[model samples]
Target: MLSAVPRFAKIAAVVVLAAAASLATFDIADARRAGSSGFGSRGMRTFDTPAITRTAPTQAAPIDRTMTPRPQQQPAAQPPLGAQQRPGFFGGFGGSMIGGLIAGGLLGMMLGHGFGGGFGFLGLLLQIGLIMLAISFAMRFFANRQRTQYAGPGASYNNSAMNNANASPRPSFSIPSIGGGTAASQKARQANDEIGLQQADLDRFEHLLTEIQSAYGAEDYATLRRLTTPEAMSYLAEEFGENATHGVRNSVSDVRLLQGDIAEAWREGDSEYATLAMRYSSIDAVVDRATGKLVDGDDRNPSETTELWTFVRKPGSDWVLSAIQGTGTH
Candidate 1:
């Protein structure tokens, strides 16, 4: 009876979780209907499920022909210009916060509920908590997607403007010669005296580097939004998206900031611009998405790698990752 109870509870929990997910999806659809923009400016997506796809109409059309004269029939409202159909929940969730939270919470809760506590009342509570967590994650995800899609005074667009105005066509300045042998001489040299970095500037710059390192390590892209410029963020997001699809993650292990040089510092009308050259090392890892196992061609262990990053800064402003070129040392 006890075993049967647990099995029944497990089935019930799955059904409840599925219902919650459906409810959340329905809420999202309703929200889109209510808004001027729907589903990130994309309409409903195709269903993969054969059962659902068979019944779901590809396009909406009036069923009544004789009752309502064809001439009197109203044409369907058209979507705004340049709008693309949005992907399904799986597509939107894969590289997003909701996906991560759902993956982590459900796995943990399943672990606890399935085996721990001998599948008692506590197990049922865990399952419920897991479902609620998943719903919350989905809600937050939909909200974030909406914000990114529709928020006014868009950060990425603003950053794009700034980048266009601030970024130089060519390398603005070169680093002074660092005294050493062949390898050291190849690196940019640091001047004997201080490079005239303000305390606040240094602090902010370090903070940004740290944030980038953390984000790179954990593959948490949401946090990277604030730490990196739009260009860098877009690049990372693309890499992450590819990784999710390909089932391989490029992980950075150790980030060693060897020498940093303020290659150039100047001011435009309102914003200040500085170009910094930074050298660092990391361990790039590629692993399977399902098994979390290292794939062939990539080192099983963390490998030594080097990178030179160029950052741009504005007055009393945030440090933005501008460029990066890296190489691995096998």
Candidate 2:
């Protein structure tokens, strides 16, 4: 045992060191794009899930940080006024008998009766069987009582009426199929129609994607503030601050949109929101701040990334970045 102590201590130290290294690696990877998960607000739909699109078929990560308040849930329905509340299982005579049996068994054990009134293990088993039987009988009795209560004169009439309503054939209308477009395009068109997104709006979205990447890479706080909401700017600024503290800087450039479509668009009061799924290619890399030497990522080859970016605008204002959600590596 004395010799084994050193071996155990060595093993524990190795495990701890391994865990710490893994965490450090994860932290570096997370800082690559918008700090891993989603952040910023989407107005009233901040917590709501966005629709899946061609660019982002998988579910987008939920926004973990937002200034928007969560919608309140409706209260549960209450029982009808003056209606008698149903008694719980333990409120009846059957429950009293079971309770007494359990108490008696506990008392028997305390008095050295082996939970069977001094009759030993076989008696204990017999008592358990009897208790199970009592429980079965109680359940059946309660079930029958509930059934009888609802089996009134009006019950048959109500059931018949429901059957008749369901049996009747309902008239159907045929919707003309949209001709010659992929399912993704159809879905995108439908989403765009919801908020009246024009071609100009889409062109602006592509432009902003490139502009934001360029601004972020350059650490141009002014341009970032102009292009994004205050809430979004805060998160981006926080990521930048973290990179500076770690003695590194993120370099992103040559951003080009490969594929993109509107995931969802809606209007809440005066503010119009559009969540777009975009697959874009950019030269993203991290470099040592002091020497400007490459620390991580390929600076030469532009890497592709799929993300859901939500933009918000008022009546006559240009759309601004409101949220950024990663759809994993793909």
Whose lDDT is greatest here?
Answer: 2
Query: All candidates: CA RMSD in angstroms?
Result: 21.7, 14.2
lDDT per prediction? 0.48, 0.74
Clashing residue pairs in candidate 1, if any?
177-189, 178-189
In terms of lDDT, model 1 sits at 0.48
Candidate 1 has a TM-score of 0.37
Candidate 1 lDDT over 122-209, as tens digits, reads 6756665775666668667877887888666588756655564454422211212222233332222222112344534534554566
- lDDT tens string, model 2, 1-330? 334333433443344345446645764676665434799998888897776655565667888888888888889779899998877565876678777766665444544453455555556556655665666567668867877786775689557545644553221111111212244334445553477666567767878999999999999999999999999999999999999999999999999888776777889999999988888899999999899899999889999998889999998899999999877764
Q: Give me candidate 2's TM-score against the actual structure.
A: 0.58
RMSD of 2: 14.2
- Candidate 1: list runs displaced more than 4 Å: 1-196, 296-304, 326-330
